[model samples]
Target chain A: MATKLLSRYPWATSPFVIGAPMRVMSGPALAVAVSRAGGLGFIGPGLKTTDTGVDLEEASSLIDKARASSFKTLSSSSLLPVGVGFQLWSDDLSTAMGTIEKYKPCAVWLFAPKEGQKDLDEWSRRIRAVSPETQIWIQIGSLGEAKSILQSSEKPDVVVVQGTESGGHGRMADGMGIMTLFPEVADTLASSHIPLLAAGGIADGRGVAAALCLGASGVVMGTRFLASSEARISRGYQNEVVRASDGATNTTRTLLYNHLRGTYGWPPEYSPRTIINKSFIEHRAGTPFEELKKRHDEAAKSGDSGWGPDGRLATYAGASIGLIHNVSDAERIVRDVRNDASRRIQGLAAA
Target chain B: MATKLLSRYPWATSPFVIGAPMRVMSGPALAVAVSRAGGLGFIGPGLKTTDTGVDLEEASSLIDKARASSFKTLSSSSLLPVGVGFQLWSDDLSTAMGTIEKYKPCAVWLFAPKEGQKDLDEWSRRIRAVSPETQIWIQIGSLGEAKSILQSSEKPDVVVVQGTESGGHGRMADGMGIMTLFPEVADTLASSHIPLLAAGGIADGRGVAAALCLGASGVVMGTRFLASSEARISRGYQNEVVRASDGATNTTRTLLYNHLRGTYGWPPEYSPRTIINKSFIEHRAGTPFEELKKRHDEAAKSGDSGWGPDGRLATYAGASIGLIHNVSDAERIVRDVRNDASRRIQGLAAA
Candidate 1:
């Protein structure tokens, strides 16, 4: 336990796991950017009904980009190991496995599996059968969820723990929060053979320092990186990120935007945190899920227009929005975090 | 812009600004509890060298039963005019104020003459002279320094603001601080225009919501009351705040802490935001300030003997170390700030 805990995660260079299956947001441009930044990047087949985006064809192109870049970095310096993410709940494994087989990406992240642990075990078996080089990474909400994965027949390379501070889709119970949950899960998994990646609310290098002290080898920052040049979100949405006030970023899990956009099927404990923007204000706020679904259907027909606070566009932001005040290159952020975290660690050790 | 910000600062009733001075931590027993639960309890007189503490023959009572209950919510409540605070930059304000003032305080506060904003032209003048019925509150970062009053030739009914984050010093660059500065001059007033106070890093709600926020209509606090029972700091330090992290605080004008600790103080560029334990390890990583200062002076000590990076025995603690970590009486803190400030204003307003 002590040796593994002290050593670097076996599969990746740093504990900083990049979000996988970033949907429309995780294009090849962003993947290369995040990869160069130190955090691993994953390509996703966007199933979001928001804007017309990435499918398997797009995924193939993104994989090609990642594979090309992987060789560049893999030879240049120690790489954080780039990967591809898939929403197992909505995706067909064969299609995802096909991508995995071709690229043999460093990792394959699976989320929201249909049969839960059974799905993870089956996918792990299937992926291993096809591509021996590709490692498996699983994202889970609760300690119980993590336990189930660890208890599975085929162990995963890493467990990405998503606390409530996650910006996109995640567990939304008031009882679940980054402050308490991260430590608890980290402690519980301390005895397990698997390494853990703490996700949510980690913005700066300092946050990385704190999380490392809490037992996580590294962290996966989502909203912090959303405003970077690499992400696929619009300039208007990205600017909203740069201009956001701390008071304006309070969040809660509501089916408001999803229902209004006709994108259903986010499992119950999972809700996204976002700012009160044009689309949400006009269409969702007080409307019921059923009513929202109707509005979503209607908007889908009209080629979605505008981004007012009342407009129906989704601003998938998180609690860490307060810290992201600029649009920067992802590599700069990555370099800064690595150096800062290293400095802080040396400081702690010396003290 | 000055008037607008100034106007918003005074949400108090009448002309009075109470002081919610506290000791150790701003537990309910010391300042906040007193202000919220009693009549205005002038928060503190941080920095041991201040003379206000020596001559005060007023009611002196000690309250320390309800430890560990202080928090920030005490400020937002629209309860009695409450206060808590310090002598601008005092090393002993906590203990001294905790002894004399116990109960509802009105205002507790402090403001130093920052590098860029040198003049005390707008907000300070307005807060001190709010109609004839308001309490004139003033906090001096140094005993030899009352730049606002000296500049405007206008005195607050109560002048506070004391030593830097020290156990016994003022914020002035030299040997001056709120301690040696506040009392020496509080007694030198020609017209009872304002009562002098001390402050800097007070750590309790009693010191915060009580003594400073509500005292004098306002009292000053920097370190006290901020570490109340409900407020969160690292556990290793919180457990030691009262009995351990108290007594030997010190302050200096340098970017030492932030640079060593890992927080960027930019855009709102100002002094170091000193958290007691954040820089322990970093302090050891660099050239020893102690050794450097030794060459600068035989012994002008920011890091003399016991004050290392890890176990910083001397925190940026005010004189109010005894009253921290308890949910002190907020009513008392409120009453004190309200009553004291009101008394000054009431007398003048009526005349």
Candidate 2:
């Protein structure tokens, strides 16, 4: 199955762009929209649940709907194959493998493994055995992790190099920027022949073009798609992404937001980049965690008004927020970025 | 002077790739080599003397030698119009102005102004009055500083956006990456029509190409050229740059290296990125500054051998060290990067 995917990789009409499997935000609808527009898209980890199993059921239904809708829009040769992601550390293996067996996604994105390469190897093997057509895609934040992946017994079919400027959880202490990291990783893994995808801080055509220049086979954009109508994000969060500029000033990597939202148990090595708000300001001023959480909860009740300067909610985004302005359709975002990148590359060649 | 430079900017064959005015490293030879290779280059601020007039005299001689040599290789139309840089806070303004007037450099790079925009405006005015043909280029690290530049009474011909990943002095507390900062500054100043250049962690063709995608009219590389034969860098430092990889693990931004080298007095808002050595390890382990400095001074006497893992000397480099594998001629570095970027851009377009 991996071989089949690799065979088709080089002949794609446009440079591959992935709708990153951002937890909660990236859904089957978004995935179908992107894949139908000639890019790969993934249903994120949040769709897989442990207790009631309602999330998985909904995901299965959405996947069915997406396939029908995508088949009508895309050519038969261009596969509208939706990928699926799983948080390796928290997700139950049997449940994930069972779901994969049921859906047979084109790709499986594994992230935040508790046992690192050991778990990654196990997950890859399991996915391959259950659904041979599913290619393994592992996300790494640093060169050390990339090296580990290369040294593993079972290698991934695709490597996603996520830089610190990425919106969600990434390297906490040491992470190189995509401009340098992507090329270095590409150079180091040149012999492997595995396709590399760049993520983090990429928002538009310029970023897509730049990623290609940096030796990436494709680019996976999480933040840019967050502003898409298909993304399952709040109006407040979407508004913040549109209004924001200068990510260095507006966003901070912190575990505070996750803790406030009652989502905990993520590895200590990672932190999400969130837009700075009153909660973050108060946290920096030495306010106790309990007090801040209380304020955050109170603000959450206010709905859309709960995420501004005076609000206390997380607005997950990357530094590339400055480039994102309006909320548009998922297909428009993907198509525009691809067309713009193509034009820019050709323009550069002419110049 | 600014008007003439601005008028000629659009006609440059390739996107400008400046050998940045790295203090003590970027010399007249490097500036001339880059200029001869179809890019702008600047002799660094180290040539500007505070009290003694010897430095300026030596610079004048080097410039003369560079011109004579450059004339042999470059066409008359492609003038070796070398630039000059100054540490505005420390340099004696009259002496620096007098030197610029005599040399009639094509551009002037002003850094570390004590009074920010006010000082920058005054310097721009002074340089214009002395040499009307010399373009003013200011380096900034944040959107706020860019805004300040935009609001200044006298605008510069070019703005160099220096990210935290840069090698030398840059914004410490609130620096943004070029991917986001460049586009934001570009959009904000679009109405003004000021050309923006990206600096920091750019080493090879991929970096140059990526910077172009990020909306930079040019790129200013300090560390990439440090490995060039024309740069005035020590063999030890150059070797480390070639050997280093995984910039996230190898390089760190700290004032410890600056203090150890007895090159203190930079403003509190700046720090330099250097490869981790004995001094940095000890500093991280809580060694007293006095002890670290003593060890560093002792290691400096050992010459080339004093810059490795056990050595205490600084190996200043950007996070792009992984891409720099060898020390090559300045002209080769410039031409190869340009050609490679052109090829990559074209290749992507075809793909």
Candidate 3:
């Protein structure tokens, strides 16, 4: 019904904003919490690499429980939107699809697929085969992809334009920023008429108002919301985001974090935004991959917490992370996005 | 020949880049002077709002002299691409055409016109009719405006996407900044079969490289050039952009400088970025037109040296003004832009 409604009115608003799928932070409880706060949420299907013993089944199980909670809430009220996401390049598609068949998500967002394998047709068809209403929101790092999506037969229901300042794996070639990419995509794809959402360095309502002026109907904030109470991030991790500055975050495509977790075999182009810790600094210029592998294997067994400014773990954040300073409730973050936009708009009109 | 060649390939390396026509600052001397430096230049037939005491006779005399210099250089070397611009909203069609005939510029740039003006067709016809080989460039504030230009009959040879940080008048509707605005336009227009240039907030080569990544073929810098020895700004003024920090500048749409200089009659939606100062703080909110008029009458008679921060006149700069450290020659500015972009790109690639 939501799909039918969205298709009927392309310009209509949606209170249903799914949390951008973070690897470890967002899960079943987070999804339910966001829905309770009057917005949609998602379960991150982390990096589902083709390798064995990764245990994605746990996240899938949590979703089933969330559905039960959703069902109970819907018994008294309306159904809420919920979803999952995958790193298209690193993940195992067949196993992932099996979970999707059993527990249908409201949407599935994908990012950083292999250069030669942009199998949009197969991916779109498979998701729709299970449930045609489920949206396939693909994150694009450049305008070329935005145009390609508009022109492709497997047209995305919603396009997410991520700037270089985005926290996770992003495009290095022509990594257009969010500000220019949003409005230009909005103008060119006006004919295709898909709902556009901005996802990069957006922390507050002023960011939301700026996006709206540049042509987005709404925004998707990641690091900002990561500090929410419902998110499963460490108290220390959440505090770091609150304390970070625009100048503090360092971006790179290195596999330091993946290696530290014993998670190798990822694409070369996609870099993560993390703070410059001692370990990264020591090894960044070049540490023998063998030495890095040994260090990574030891750290994975010990748990990532032992790592600090001198640790191996990466702390991913967008440029807007500087604007955040508090570890507040998720509901307050949502309210800030709404209220700040209203303030700027009203301020301009009054002047 | 060079003019025609540049039209065919605007991004092709050349010492002579056409100086963008600007209200108040642009004049016959500006056009010819820039051309003398081996760069093409234009005379701004600013809107009726810009009262520089420049009559048609004076404008024609300047153009005539520039043409003589251009022809002398062209005969000895290659022809210079001199041009004129019109504020599309402020002037009538007859006036635009009459200026074209009397001054005979190689091209015409249009800016900030009312939507659906019938004069577009007339001006388009006159431009091609008089100088069929002449190029037409249109300056637009947003990507939506770029899309609008594609629909217009007179497709510009080059479309300048002017972002909010520009020194001149622009849509303050939410202040979507240069970082977001540039890439959006560049990526969207990459497929349009025209070369794109990034403008606003560009001070050096890192900016140029970033623009390239955002899909722009070139960059147009205004603020950095304003502080150059070749530029007509005050000696004290050049020192300010050199020593200022990013925090020193704030964007506002006040007409303080123009009012102090006795210029007015601008549209309400347009605003420009200005550095903050004491008098600006006192009247930053804005003053009544009558109150401003009274203040201007006194300042003119006294001939106040509006040179420093506390003076009534405002210093306009983009966010990147902090990068500047000295008032170098215009040629050095160009060299630095090329060098900085090369180093950043090299460093990123090397990393």
Candidate achieving the largest TM-score: 2
Model 1: CA > 4 A from native: A1-20, A48-72, A75-81, A247-250, A282-305, A308-310, A344-351, B1-351
Judged by lDDT relative to the true structure, which candidate is superior, 2 or 3? 2
Q: Considering summed lDDT, which 10 consecutive residues are worst modelled in model 2 chain A?
A: A71-80
lDDT per residue for candidate 2 within B223-293, as digits (tens), equals 88999998888998888888878888889889888777777677777788889988999899999999888
Choose the strongest candidate by DockQ: 2
Best of the candidates, lDDT = 2
lDDT rank order: 2, 3, 1
Q: Cα lDDT of all candidates, in order?
A: 0.48, 0.79, 0.57
Q: What TM-score does chain A of each model score against the native chain A?
A: 0.82, 0.92, 0.81
Per residue, candidate 3 scores C-alpha lDDT tens digits across B270-294 of: 6666665544665656756566556
Using Cα atoms with residue i matched to residue i, what is each candidate's TM-score against the true structure?
0.50, 0.93, 0.50
Model 3 lDDT per residue over A1-351, tens place = 234434322322342244677775776666555544545566665544322123334444553465576544422322225557777776777766776666565677777667522566567778788766677888776656766786678887777777555665666544544544454455567797787777776666655554544445456777777778878776656766676553222434455766665666555656666655545776866887677667655654555453445445566666555567787777666666666555554443232
Q: What share of the true interface contacts does candidate 3 keep?
A: 0.04
Q: Model 3: runs farther than 4 Å from truth? A: A1-17, A47-80, A115-118, A248-253, A284-307, B1-351
State in Å the error of residue A210, model 3.
Answer: 1.1
| Model 1 interface CAPRI class | incorrect
Q: In model 2, which regions exceed 4 Å deviation? A: A1-13, A47-70, A73-80, B1-13, B47-80
For each of the candidates, give the backbone clash count.
229, 2, 7
